[model samples]
Target: DGRCLKDIHCLELAEFRWTLKQAFGSSQPSARYGHTAAVWPPESEIPGRDKDSEFLFVFGGHSAVSELNDFFAFHIESSTWVKVDTGRQTSGPSKRFAHKWDWSGLKT
Candidate 1:
C-alpha cells in the first residue's frame, strides 16, 4: 500500500502503532525476525513536558532494514509506547525521507 523511504524518517501515528504490534508479534513472527526488520530504525529524541519543565530524551531500537515508515513514541511516566494518530486530514510533514523532528514544547 506504500513505498519505503531510503535513508528517510517517517513520523506517522498509524505507523507508530503498527510498529508496536509488529514488535510484539507472535512467537513465530518474532523467531523469524522478518517483521522487525521492516520497521523504523533506532533514533534519539528529546520530549518536552511543558514550556518550563525539563526535557526527556528517549532512544529507539534499531530495525533490521534501513527503510522505515513506522513511528513509535514512548511515555516516560508510563514507560510504554504511546502511538500517536495523525488523522487523514492532518498535514505537517512528509512521512518519508531523512527528515528530522524537534520538540518545541508547545501544545496545539
Candidate 2:
C-alpha cells in the first residue's frame, strides 16, 4: 500500500530502545516508503535567528503507481511538516531509494 506513518517515534537511548509515541502536526508527508532520511542536529549552522532547531528531511520514494522525487521537512521545535518545492522534477535528482545525504566541510 501507499500508506505512510506520520507518527514520530519516541526513544530511550540510554536503554538502547524506543517506544512508539503518538504525535500530530498540521500536515504530513504523503503516504510513502523507501525514502531516505537525514537530520541536522539542533543548534547547528542555519540561516536566520532560529534556536533549538532539529530537522528531519525525507526524500525520494515510490508509491503503487509512480516514483516520487518530493521532499518533506519536519521541524522539531514547532512539531510540523513542511513540503519543500524543489522546482521542476526534470532538473532534480531522479527518483531513487537507499540514498545518503550529508554535509561536507564548513563553507561559508
Candidate 3:
C-alpha cells in the first residue's frame, strides 16, 4: 500500500507470505505502469523457475506525457534487470495502455 522503490516482491505460497525479492545488479528497468508482463512468452517458450529463461518481461507502457515503447526483462534467477533491445529503430507496436497480455498461442 505504499511505494515499491523498484523492489520486486515474490509471493511465498508455501508460507503464505510476501517476500521482497533480493535484487542485484543495476541495469533494472525504470518504474513504469500500463505496460505488459508475462511469465511465459507468447508461446510456452521456457517455463518459469527454469535454468535458461527465468525472466519477467515488461514491455510498452504509458508515461505522464505519452505512450512508451520500451522493453525490459527481469531475470528472477539472477535478480537483475536488462533492457531488451527489440532491434526496432521505429515503432514496434501500436501505443497502448491499461491492457493485459496473455498467451493464447497467438499474438497478445
Candidate 4:
C-alpha cells in the first residue's frame, strides 16, 4: 500500500476524465516520487525522427529507499518509455527529489 508506482495516467480534455496509459518499452524507470517531468522541443518535431511523436522527459526522484538521478523519456504517440544514458564520461547530476524543471524555448 505504501509502494511507489511507475504507472502513468493521462487526462482527456474532451472526455474530462483520466485514463491509464498502457506503456511499453525495453526498460522502465523504477517507481518514484518527487520527480520532475517536462515536454521538450515544444510544438516541434525531433530531427531525424517521425514528426508524430513527442517526448516527455522525466528526471530525479526518490525511490522507496533512496533518491535517484536517472533520466528517461516517454514517447507519447508510441506509448513507450526509453531510458536516457548520460554516458560514462559524465557523472551527471546527483541523486535528488522534489525538484522542479522548466524549459526555456531559447533559440540560437
* Cand. 2 Cα-lDDT: 0.68
Q: lDDT by residue for model 4 over 44-86, one digit each (tens)?
A: 4355665455678899899999999899999988889999986
Q: RMSD in angstroms, all models? A: 12.9, 4.4, 3.8, 3.7
Candidate 2's TM-score: 0.66
lDDT of each: 0.30, 0.68, 0.68, 0.82
Task: Looking at model 2, report the run of 10 residues with the lowest lDDT sum.
Answer: 42-51
Model 3 lowest lDDT segment of ten = 40-49
Clashing pairs in 1: 8-97, 8-98, 9-97, 13-84, 16-71
lDDT leader: 4
Model 1, poorest ten-residue lDDT window?
Answer: 25-34
Residue 104 shift from truth in candidate 3, angstroms: 4.0
The candidate, 2 or 4, that scores higher on TM-score is: 4
Model 3 C-alpha lDDT per residue in residues 29-102, reported as the tens digit of each score: 65556778876443255345354555788777776567767777887767788888878737577677678766
TM-score of each: 0.32, 0.66, 0.70, 0.81
Tell me which of candidates 2 and 3 scores higher on TM-score: 3
Give RMSD (Å) of candidate 1 vs. truth: 12.9
Ranking by lDDT: 4, 3, 2, 1
Candidate 1, residue 22: lDDT: 23
Displacement of residue 60 (Cα, Å) in model 3 is: 1.6
Which whole-number lDDT from 0 to 100 does residue 27 have in model 4? Answer: 75
Question: What's the true lDDT of residue 94 in model 4?
Answer: 85
